[model samples]
Target chain A: MIVKDAVCPFCGCLCDDIEVEVEEGRVVAVTNACELGTTKFMGEKRMKNPILRVGDEWKDITYDEAVKYAADMLLAAERPLLYGWSGTHGEAQCVGVHMAELIHGVIDNTSSVCHGPSILAIQEVGHPGCTLGVVKNRADLVIYWGSNPIDAHPRHLSRYTRYAEGFFLENAFRDRKVIVVDVRKTESANIADEFIKIRPGGDYAVLSALRAIVQGKADTIPRTVAGVTREQLVRVANLCKSAKFGAVYFGLGLTMTQGKYKNIRNAIELVSELSRHTKFTISAMRGHYNVYGSNEVNTWMTGYPFGIDFSRGIAFYNPGETTAVDILARKECDAALIVGSDPAAHFPRKCLEHLAEIPVVQLDPYPNATTAFCNVQIPVAVTGIDAEGTAYRMDGVPIRTRRVLSSDYLSDEEVLARMYALMQEARER
Target chain B: MKVTLAMKPAAKWFIPIEAESIVPKNFLSGTDLRVWRGNRELRLDEVFSVSVEGDADRAEDVEVVLSGDTFRLKRVGEYLDAGKITVLGGIGMHCGNFMSGGTIEIHGNADGWLGREMAGGTIVCRGDAADYCASGYRGGRKGMKGGTVEVFGRAGDFLAESLAGGTVIVHGDAGDMTGAEMRGGTLVVHGDCSRPAANMKDGSCYVYGTARGMIPTFKKIGTVQHDGRTLIRFSGDLANRGKGNLFVKGYEYLD
Candidate 1:
């Protein structure tokens, strides 16, 4: 059986035109999905049952025991952390938020490590963004700033900005122009009509120079601003102003750099300055497939996007303090519950040192890096592969991911729901 | 009236204690206040040995003195409208948030978000101050609206960020992005800082030492004498409204 138009559960692109061929109960082949998506779809190394750490060894545990153990641990904790919702569906994320509220814990997602700064910047100056389809069909100029689409989002350039045929332009290839800006030349930069190489940790300065040039104060700018010649800056400003519609897509390079969100803010402010002459929009090149969905769910439910603290029985949102990395590094949270994503691989050493001391429970299909720190690891079904759920694209559109194959393994929603139910029952008792 | 509260050594000192109720107005009535250690709410006496010297009917007449292991104590004087708070040792994060009045004097080092969004007050920190000192909240447009924050020692990054109005004086060096997005404020850094007043809309920033990565947007407008020191004056950040004034003794551009 072939499942047509299956959403790829990989990057934030959420390409919904994937064709998955399943034989019996397993996926045999996938078409139209990128290698990253294909690898996840055809992957078969899945943990079958729950495992418990018995001192130096591991012991197989039933789902009921695992659920009970997780509930008990969270209930006894003074400050519990519910992390990793970016890889899961929105339904599971909702349950995770409820669990945090019930336990009066902190709930954060993968965004805290990635595009959390983008949200911070957006909060300062409102986002001027458009859907991917709009940029694909309408934009005559696309700027990939601090983002390399060729490596990360493999299909982002071909499907949305650079290679996609536009409705407004008669000759899409001839009329459209592409510019890539990075600290180093990337594969995406190789194909750009213009590539501006900047000094490392100099994005903020470069962005401010552009904004000044756009505001007709070019004389104030230095001869060379952060390795880019002033003449090049003025030329880029002119190109932006001359373009009928331009779109900017940035990645972690800008959000996780030295200046962090301030860089993104400066970029957005530049886009606002450009809007006075031409139509301009800026968006983040989100990594995780449902990371945007996680932000969306967290924002709608908790009034804040990510890194929320419910320890005081009120929703307190502060990224630097309540985030998982900071909380773990500060040795603040007593216990942690990881789902969807892994922190052991990405987090700093100080955070992992504290993670090793805490009682942790994780819900993931496969045993990843974070499993090494967990006392109990529950195997769950993968969303968008065998379990159907709602996900959000990078452009803030909700896409319903369809299951290409059926499996007996429980989904994240089921496991988290069971944990939340047990916790609620214990609270009532 | 004088109130002295000494901290009790906790089994878990790493977990911060939120004590926003320690303001002078809240203590005007009595010491019947609540504080939170993680998720557990405890009485004022549970975390501190409270002692009152005399009775006071008004908030201004009351004086609260905190001593001992107060580094992990957060939100000490939030929304403090009057009175005085003196920390003998290092104070925790959010020391004087949104304070419209009063004086906070910390003898030792201070943590992050010191005097955050403080509208009107005087915060005197004799020791070093951490990141976000006298800055705004996450994504807030205005930081220290109307207050005087005098840090005797060095300050961390993003000091007085989004400073809309008020005066901030650092006797020592400040970290990166000092007075960023400043609209209306007078910032004086006795020592060097990087990228002073980047993207500021309106304000006057005086850096007695070198300004590293001097933003390219500011236009030099001759030299001026300020506080008995001759400094080069510049009008910027042209990236924004270009109304802010920046004065630096020496500067280096990240050309």
Candidate 2:
């Protein structure tokens, strides 16, 4: 059986043009997807059974028992934290938020650790943004700052920025000017028309200088800022100013550094400043397929975006304070309910120590670092493979994820709904 | 009049409660105020135990004490012209958003957008504050145009971003972008700042401790003495031809 126009739930691109060949309820071949997507669709490292951590040993448990155990732990605790909804569908996230509210817990997503700084910056200096279609259609000057989409988002350039032909531009690659700014020459930089090598943690300085040059404040800027000369900065500013339409896509390189949100703020402000001269927009290179969806859903349900806390019987938000990393490191929660993310592997040592000490319930399709550490582990069907739901792209475009295969296991939404129901029933009792 | 609203411990608010309507100015006549609970409009009495002790017509004359955790309450004191609102626990997002006049004292930590687009007010968070405090919303250019926000504890990133006019003081360490894209404002951090001021058009940021990162757009203008303490003053966010001033305490020279 061949599945057409299936959305790949691997990365934030949400490439919906994939064709999957399924045989015996398993994906055999995937076409039009990157290597990462192929690996995800193939169910590599997929966990089969629900496991429970007992006396430092993993024991397979039935789905019903897993749900009961998860609910029990959540209800028993004074303060339970629900973290990570970026990998699941919007439906599951809605249920998860409800669960968090009922339990008076802290609910946060992966963005708290990643593009959260970008969100903060966007909230500060409003984003001059455009959809991927707009970038493909009108953008003539494309700048990739502190991000290597070649290795991360392999199909991004060919599908949207560099090679994709739009209505106004025939030969997109030839018609557009590509600029890459990073600490080192990356794979994406190798193919760019201009590559500006910046010193580590110098993104803010470089971005500010570029903004100064664009705003005609060059007199105040030093000849050499962040190792980039005045001539290079001026040339880049001129290109941005002269372009009919410009788009900048930044990644963790900007958010993870010392400046964090400041780097992104400078970049966004620069793009906003460029808009004064020409049409310019900016977007964060969101990593997960539904990470943007998690934020969108959380924003609609709660006034705040992410890092929400409901422990006080109301939804509260604070990034550094309420984020998963900080909350876990602080060891504030008595119990934790994690969904669709593996913080045990990704978080720092201090955070992992707190997570290990707590009673954790993890709901995911695969058994990873979190599964091994969690007290109760529930196996759910893989999104876009054995389950279908709504997912948002990196640019905040909602797309329907199609299921190409069947699975006996429950979906993430079903599991969360069941958990919510179980918790409600237990509370009443 | 002094109004005290305490949340019942058993009450778990799944739907966001918009408490902007429960300001002191609206309760002078002791009329039952209605707030939105999800899609339904419910009276304040249904969720909170409302009691009015004193009598007053103006918002500033009224004292409102909101006890318990109100982290789920959205827009706590939005669009307040005058009043004194005190939250015993943490507050949700948009706590004092668009407040022209008022005093919101949060005894506990605060969520993001603590004083979003606040035109005038005094917001004091005894605990830490989340991101976007005294900052603008998405697509907005002007942030806390005029106000005073003091966080006794740490503050998250993007503190006072795009601040048109305001005063923000943090006693504890601040995350990145202390005063970013600030057109006008006065931001003082007694603790360490990750990355102080970037792309600021006009503003003044004084750091009593260390500033982790510095933008090349700022030129060091030599040290100055303030309150018997040595401080290094720098000018320019030269990116936007901004005449912003950044003063760091016990500053070391950086080439």
Candidate 2, what DockQ?
Answer: 0.22
Residue by residue across B142-206, what tens digits does model 1's lDDT show?
88999899999999989999998899999999999999999898999999999999999998999
After superposition, the stretches of candidate 2 with alpha carbons farther than 4 Å from their true spots are B1-195, B201-203, B206-213, B219-236, B240-243, B247-255
Residue A153: error of model 1 in Å? 0.2
For model 2, residues B1-255, the per-residue Cα lDDT tens digits are 899998754332433466778666887877588875433467788878887786886778998888875776768888877988999998877898899998999999998889899999899999999888898866567888998999999999889988889899999988887887788889998998866877777888889999875666777899998767789999857776668888888442222
lDDT of 1 at B8: 90
lDDT of each: 0.93, 0.84
What RMSD does each model have against the real structure? 1.1, 6.5
What lDDT tens digits, residue by residue, belong to model 1 across residues A360-427? Answer: 99998898998899999999988988898999999999999999888999999999999999999999
Residue pairs with backbone atoms closer than 3 Å in model 2 (clashes): A126-B139, A314-B71, A314-B72, A315-B71, A315-B72, B1-B54
Task: Give lDDT tens digits, candidate 2, residues A1-429.
Answer: 999999999989999999999988778999999999999999766678788888978888998899989888888776677899999999999998888888777789999888998987777667888789999998999999999999989999989999899888877879999999999999999999999998787887788778878878787677787778888999999999999999999999998887677678778889888888889999999998999999998888887778887766778666765688876775556778999888987999988887888889898888788876688888898889988899999998999999899879899999889889999988788
On the 0 to 100 scale, the lDDT of residue B43 in model 2 is 78
